[model samples]
Target: MQTMLTTLILGATIAAAAPLTARSLVSDAAGQTYDYIVVGCGVSGLVVSSRLSENEDVTVLCLEAGALDHYEDDILVPYYIGLQPDGFYEWGIYTVPQTQLDGESRHIPMGKGVGGGSLINGMVWNRGNQESFNAWNDVGNSGWGWNALLPYFEKSETYTPKNYSGAEVQPELQNPSVHGTSGPVQVSYPNYYWPQTNNWFEALHELGIPTSAEPNEGLSAGGYFLPLDIDPINQTRSDARRSYYDPIIARTNFNVQDNSQVTRVLFDTSDNLTATGVEFATGASAPRQTVYARREVILAAGAIHSPQLLELSGIGQSSILEPLGITVLQNLPGVGNNLQDHGMIHLNYNYTSPVLADVNDFAINATFNDESAAEYYGSKTGPWTAKPSCAVAFPSLEQVTESASSMLAAASSAAYNLPSTYDDEPTLQAGYERQMASVLSELANENIPAFENLNNNAGGLDLALMRPLSRGTTHITSTDPFTTPSVDPRWLVHSFDYDVMILAMQVNQRILNTDAIKYLGPSYEYIPQDATAEELGQILLSGIGTEYHYSCTTAMLPLDLGGVVNEVLMVYGTNNLRVVDTGIFPMVPGSHLQAVAYGVAEKAADIIKAAQ
Candidate 1:
């Protein structure tokens, strides 16, 4: 029932209790100093420590290994975001081996502590696809196009939308001048949505697909009920610690250490990485300390701890820090290479009359906007802000050009440049290790489930093979900045991320046998229409996963392509470091990568405050 209302709003017998508040580092218990340190309060370290503490003399620390959230229910519901996988704010990261499927091992769940992965995601806000930032300004990433990041996604948004149904405006496909009405992140649209899935919007206007009232504008292929960063006047889950830390937690020059952790980054003595300081350690404590920042360090520890804290402070690659002895200070080799992620395939169905069930009692999460779902209850809006996949279908890869996208983007960019040796290595040429012993040699491959019928029936088609040219690699076996390395998001290991996860599970088994969702009430389960295409390619090489949206591990290209932050995100060899997170993207944007990582940390805090 929405997993027992998310195990009764995460009191599931104190789900491993403890966190009541002890993450103090709010500064000066004798250790005060900072112009910025920001390690991992997630969502690129709390929006670059709330925009570099708006320079009230600039002092910001923010470490966070994970705690001090309190707003539980596995992160404020929204269909229990797949029941908070590995709970306790997930860091259960799993990846590594996979010649392709049979080698299995791939759970990859990221977002440990503070607002990282926007507090364990699934809030689904998408603002991507302005041709993925005009293909990152067509590869080079200048001012990141899409009209230079559409006013930083309307200055990190604050929309609202909950007048309870009645206001169904199309105004040319939902364009309220493309959104953003006050900012500080509120976004809206969900109050409950179910009306027998609004007959798939008249089967998506009888499959012509044009019904936008603003699906975050910038063309989202087709299929739309979009908008859901959440808040719709208190319906919760507006993450980034409630859209950028509760509208600036009383600001006094922001400190925020919480459960601490930082570990390395200390330098000085003409090694030149100045303003020295940082060594944390609190949660599960054992007496560890240090905290100095006087000027700048910003890493936003994401996309796998920002390239394992820039190869544990020596700054990356001397063939990966001379055999882990360490000390290689910036050879860069793309500190953790071009990781990239977005590989789905979860086509579950089995509706007879619960039309894709909406369990969770207390009368569906406390009156999911009452008035008996009044077009969405008492004037808020309708179909309760419909999320569960509320219309989304971005096709193209010439509908899986044989087995999928130029046979697995030449074998996952040669398993991501054969481990950053880099000279254009990317050429794994889709054998998907061996295409899983040729899953039924080619059981009627069927062009994207005959162009999205998504296993025909009562709505349920999740075919999302966005940008998966198969690239993956986030190295660092050891140097121990805090050690978690070896992130290998080599998902679908390649073969166009295993033919775009078996062409989005063969277009959710051709929309369960379409005719506009086969007389509404479709039926397919997990994935078994009597198996074989070698058992749906070993249940999609082994259930294709990770949409935490990782990204090019600190990439910000140009240094002969193995870039590690340059176009003003600094880092190439340090001098004040800086990274801001989704680890400097450099590519991966089909959408929903947290409003483009808050418009690339709000244009990297205006190029680090116009270079100080």
Candidate 2:
């Protein structure tokens, strides 16, 4: 009995010493070579690595620049959504001063740890409108349409129905067939809804926008309760670490090195455009080291960093790389072009009702209460178990405005009638023409939502321009990988975006005027109720910010259309290298990016496996 006890103790010690955390330092894996080296342990990185490591023969290594989450309560609790992106687990990136947004720059928070943006996001799980994905197929990317990608969306999540007895469940909130029952990520509605959400739903119905059956099924243009990526049983935030990484971390073939940043991808000295390995560092003072990739190098460094890495590796335009004294490896002009993000403006209102619950009351109030923490830790149910419930509405151009045709005509003319800058590159012109054609058709058919309204239930309404005609770019000013890139989203540059935002504000006013919402005793706190269109437009200019849905810096269109990667997600000028993140998206889908990012990673895994 004593011998057995000693053996168990020694076994525990051995297990503890085994590098189970997947957070290895650079010194621990200096000379290692992996079958696949994945840079960035974000959603795409985790999903792709987890999938690729399923085959026991293949070794996958993931390098992340941030440390393990350590189960931070702010990240684990769903109600702490507002507090998660505190620069602890975030990159805390800031964009360049926008020329259109009153010459002001905005803070862009991106996830830095194993889970990436999923750890720092609002946890909203939206799969986007089907036509948006079909638009990718229309732009010469075959097999990327909604029908082809729907299965991948289903493959990444396990949906749970909200089962609390006291809560009301709506049939329109979910569709079981469209959601996966067995998957890594957990997605479901909150156990309880804020009292004001029902009023908002009724208000939308009264405003003539019917509730959607299931937003994830793709026809998401209507009012509905936004689904969250939370585990119903545990009542915890279901981020990429909890979903994709935790389950497979025990595999010997999979290794994740945290607090290790990949500086650049290494290539062969030969004439062949072949990627051989990657260079990384432990921290600012640590010496850089090389790690070879036997098969391929997958870059999931996200929209902003992916392009920065490419440029640092001499794969961007000659004009940008030559000035830095970096040899141009590929001269791909699209490496950092076509940046996009959803422009959002918040409208605040004063709730006159004394009995209604304030948004702060749902989470940690002015002071932390031990009893609330006890309630959450003991039963896994309470205010801490859910984020503030909200109602989302996707309204088309025609539904929101009577001047849809004329507005679209004006937008088309402004978009297609480009300046001499576009004339310099036929590829950029072709891509713009294709995007404009699709945007015009969408405006005419009302197939895609032009504006999205999110009712925060706490007298705050968020209006976002779902599809903007404006575009921007991100470029590396220097070769230093640690330096933040110049990110200019150029938001609201075109008058068309201004027109859509103005109409969306009007729609919000109409919703606020509805009998259901008006009964709640709400009054405008920001903009005046009688503000004219011009006055509202001025207010919007100062008020607009990002929805944090930045995408498409390294797009996947045809090479002739300013594409950095091909349909297979491989870089246009390189072999054995691929980008499997939001950067590969040819255009910004009209939804929150987390779910689409997971789907993209899943599909990328299949594509990579098939090629193998």
- Residue 301, candidate 2: alpha-carbon lDDT: 94
Residue 384 accuracy (lDDT) in model 2: 55
For candidate 1, the per-residue lDDT at 522 reads 59
Measured against the true structure, the TM-scores of the candidates, in listed sequence, are 0.36, 0.92
The local lDDT score (0 to 100) that residue 103 gets in candidate 1 is: 70
Q: Cα deviation in Å at residue 190, candidate 1?
A: 3.5
Per-residue accuracy of model 1 over 1-612 as CA lDDT, tens digit each: 334333343343222222333334453522667777788887767877888788787777788877767767557645455656465677676777765555756777777777877776777675755655655554455777788778878888877654434333322245667677987777776665454445555555554444455557666444455666776654556788766766677777786766676766776747655537767676434466787777787878788877876677777767767888887755776677667777665555755554354432223544442322333223434433343444454444344334444453344345432343444332111211222222211222321121222211233454445555556677777765555678776665445456556655655555445465566555556667656566788766666666668887777766665667777777765578778787777667665678778767777777787877
Q: Largest TM-score belongs to which candidate?
A: 2
At residue 475, candidate 1 shows an lDDT of: 72
Return the lDDT, model 1, position 576.
82
* lDDT (tens digit, per residue) of candidate 2 on 261-367: 99999998486578888999978678898899999999999999999999999898777799899998897878888788899987887566766655644343433
In candidate 1, what residue range of length 10 has the lowest lDDT sum?
447-456
Evaluate model 2: give its TM-score. 0.92
